[model samples]
Target: MVNFTHQDQGTSASCWQQAGLEQIAALDPEKLFHAMASVIVLAAHPDDETLGAGGLIRMALGQGTDVHVIVCSFGEASHPDSTTHSAAQLAALRHAELAEAMDMLRAQGPRSGTLHLHCLGLDDGKLAAQQEPIRAALEQHAGERCLIASTYRGDGHPDHEILGLLAADCALAHNACHLEFPIWFWHWAQPDRQPSFRHWFRLALDASSTDAKARALEAHRSQTTPLSALPGDEVLLSEGFLQHFSRGAEIFRATWPGHRDAASAPAVFDELYGEREDPWEYRSSRYERRKQQILLACLPQERYAAVLELGCSIGVQSAELARRSTRLLAVDASATALAQARRAVAGMDHVELLQATVPRQFPQLEPGSLQLVVLSEMGYFLAADELEQVLAASAAALQAGGELVVCHWLHPIEGWPLDGEEVHRMAGQLGWERIVEHREADFLLEILRKPAGAHG
Candidate 1:
């Protein structure tokens, strides 16, 4: 399962700003508030509303929309290990801060309801168990065509995910339009390489709205201020994380109603890669370049006869692998990426690029037919069963003593069912003798070899 501490200083907002985050799309004010008499904003914790949708709340209220703020928890567990304060103390403080924040936001606009704050008082870290309570709390606000904004269902936090999904469910049940506001996504997600870009949008916060959000966020001083000089009492939301919310606009995602179960992964990626030559900066990023160098150094042999590279994104590393193998078959799901890979390996007859998804479209692996298989920076995209299938196929394809390298980012991604550590853990269960194991703060790499005399 994915795990992380809030203390992790994450990706700087400058990277996102540089990636053209502001240029994606603008939410039309008319369409945003059209026919919606009420707006319900659900947050997993105390300050989530201020961080993710404070500007949205202000904007909705300013347009004569009655706003209801539902906070799932007081975020008491934020500093569970604090020596200076107990969980109960933190809960009271945070609850009060939330009330103050709500009051501050309410003061920003003339047209808003008095029944604004709805604190469920659920356990902070244990929200997954209280789904019924969360749903019931939202169900109380059931009405006609209310605009509901919840935390992103895949926002990488366990509590956030549960609240997001339940809020979406409630919206659907009431036939209300819903949106997802990402609180933790900005901290861990790579710039511009996330869920379908089409669903993303931003609301431009005027000076007044931006100032209101800042002041409302400031009201949550227990989160922003350190409890004491003691250890474990440090601020949870650091400057780097807060930077994500410091912008003049807040980002939100909207999904087409009634299509909850359908996701076009290939189409999402096609849009990602088609928009740019290098979406993740694989060719230019020093972090990525260093990672490739490390993976190259982990190769167990000087060369291999036949090799397969799965999820060979833009062929930056595919071209490198081409030189080490007599024949290289690189497979990717995105045709746009495959086209870029084609250019990266131009005129290299030894290299081949194919557009193929994993498991379903995964090429059959003839037992003991290949010398090497490289599964890099992928696998986490697959469901647990699908990843296991890919691993089993790679194991069957590799000849005795053949090497298989699996590498992936270590940070928590929005929708990954598994993390980098879990990927290596599952691969370790394959019983292959690990030849090389490398772990970095941001990524994980493992090179395992099929044992000699073991039937594939």
Candidate 2:
């Protein structure tokens, strides 16, 4: 269990005692809620990740949990009114600062390994255009299981909110366990007032955890102005991160679906992948061939008792799989594709349609539910590391003797993980034996089997 001690900082401790506020307790070590895998922190900018859950991260890493970070935006719009630096320069500076901060966070002593950092180069506040890149990254890192941390919707900043929503989308798309931390939510947790009484759950920070958190926050020297540079007496003493431990009096609700005032999905190819006679021509045609490859990789075989396809695009392969599988779970990231899949598979009761993404909308398949898992052409468009999440969830849901199929174009794409070969090779290392390896001149196909008696 986490241990805590109130700091004898004179007035600070006294004020809290007088106001009837107690020190938050450290996280319970025995809680089943504790995840035993790597922790992935998704942030819109540099400091947000550390500020929101630095203490928790420090504790997790110190406890030997591998830490992976994915910063979606590049912080180009930060402090936009500053006259001393250009937008590009500010972005570069912030990036450098984050690099230093990451080094510091990793410097914490772990029993075995160090933290891993992945900084995706997406536009600071423009996430819509970068969806493909983000998805690609997530697909690359889809693991057996993951503990993800990100901001909440009420975190005050628009970019933060968008990141939170996107992170949730990625979580659903990948079907991983997730936890959200809300930074800059101080406005919601003010003293018990009238109708605005904010709801919050508190966790006390132990001495060691608190010290680590302070050190991590201090790593961001670029953000602290000269006046805010004092050590323990710094002006930003509260750590600037809050979390919703309990729902409390807060009313949790989701916005209605299909109420979009704007087109959220992008225009992409809608056709059977890898079926074109001129395979090379299609493969070389920018994203056209890659799209086919992703779909094909995600849907390997027509034979299975139960199959779940997440982010099924345009019913391209869904229509084909509908003919082969006894029952299929066809999911889509785009409403456009879902609508199309609905029409394409309308007469078929074998396929259950769902509009959801990973880590968040994991299809609640029963244990030993699936015979095969396919990633197809969808893995490259996510944030790379998140792909581990999808893979982990798939592993849990897959039965013994099941096969995992992956197919992706070998063509080079900028700002994504290594090509299809690299992806398969990594997958091979994750306890699955590669049973079938198909290498076409244009794409790579791999069928990996879950070793017998592996799912105990």
Candidate 3:
């Protein structure tokens, strides 16, 4: 998708300065040190905490707030092609570096508060499959009134996005304050083309905190400099990339308690539909018509006993699906969208329309009740874990030999963490047999069948 690497010449800090980053509202130090009982920092890799939230952690620790840094992976793959060191050796070296950096911060705090470091030893670049372990680590150290901070969701990196989503969910479950800091967002994102820039809080580092962060970043020698004069051990964080974090301020996206439910998908789509009748032009677009026909042609059978469509926006395709099913249940989150859908399929007693927020609140279905589950053009709306939950729910409802069809637009959806190809790839890993695979520049169509003898 976005072709960027640590070696690329990244956007300079001067460019960001010109973009008015200095104008973000300053984080209230009194409220942070007074209201929050503790701080829990999550890092997909070792240097993330140092890069994104080092100054904030130091300030919190100086105020006697308990601080915990949870590193999800050893980041062994960062230098995979190294000729000098093996992965195990690299892991050990990074572990020691992280500890040394923590000790440096612990001494700088001057409050004698607790500063702990945790390394989960998860594999690098594959955190999408390690959601359970990530959740367990967060639950083990999180406090009731703590602030849970992690990488920015939709940070253009899969590992960072996964950690962000998990941390947000953990914060929601435990009723903790959540903040998202950006590391890659700086290197990859142009200041103008960034994700929603609302609700950002700035922490202007004091002289002591700034010096402490500078020293801690240097402790990570393997990344700041190079491990050796070898081929693969070259410097990972280029000077230009590091400049983005070395600025004397930190920015965080704040999602407090009232904001934790994520503004509700229903409200989001309602705002879009209220502005216009068909935001996506599902009824008249030739592309939409062609995609629906292709999806209909990919079905394994001529007709189905029962069918379900996860996001039947405005019900144009729901009308087509109803024609091919004995019973059809079309679901959407927006009531406005569903009302239009209701009119599209009027007088069809077999077709039912229901409004629901999925993954967080999935509709109940009897076990082995569905003959077909059609998730056409909707899976990308969910984050990684949300998509997994939907897949699990579909698996529970589909009987043996029942089919699940996924068709999604191929391009990236703005403000979302996943794309169409990623959804299909993750769904294909559920151990079900994929009987049909079709790909086009605009979309992808996949059909997976539940295996024989597997219980619903």
TM per candidate comes to: 0.59, 0.44, 0.62
In angstroms, the error of model 3 at 33 is 2.1
Q: What is the lDDT of residue 74 in candidate 3?
A: 74
Q: Which candidate has the highest TM-score of all?
A: 3
> What lDDT tens digits, residue by residue, belong to model 1 across residues 388-440?
66787787788888998999999886544567778788788788888898888
Q: Per-residue alpha-carbon lDDT of model 2 for 16-134, expressed as tens digits?
A: 23444333322353241254566677787777777676655666676777777788776766555455656787678778878777766654442733577778878876775577776
lDDT of 3 by residue, 1-456 (tens): 245887767778888778877787788877876888889999998888989988888888888888999999878899989989888988898999888888767744356458889899999899999999999999998878889999977577788888887888788677778888988877776765442343367888887778888888988888888889978889999888888887898888776653423324676688789998899888889998888888888887988988989989899999989999999999998999999999999999999899986764567899889999999877877655457667877878899999999998999686555789998987886678899999999899999999877644
For model 1 the TM-score comes to 0.59
Supply the global lDDT for candidate 2.
0.57
The predicted structure with the larger lDDT, 1 or 3, is: 3
**If both were scored by lDDT, which would come out higher, candidate 1 or candidate 2?**
1
What would you estimate as the lDDT of candidate 3?
A: 0.83
Clash number for every model? Answer: 0, 51, 0
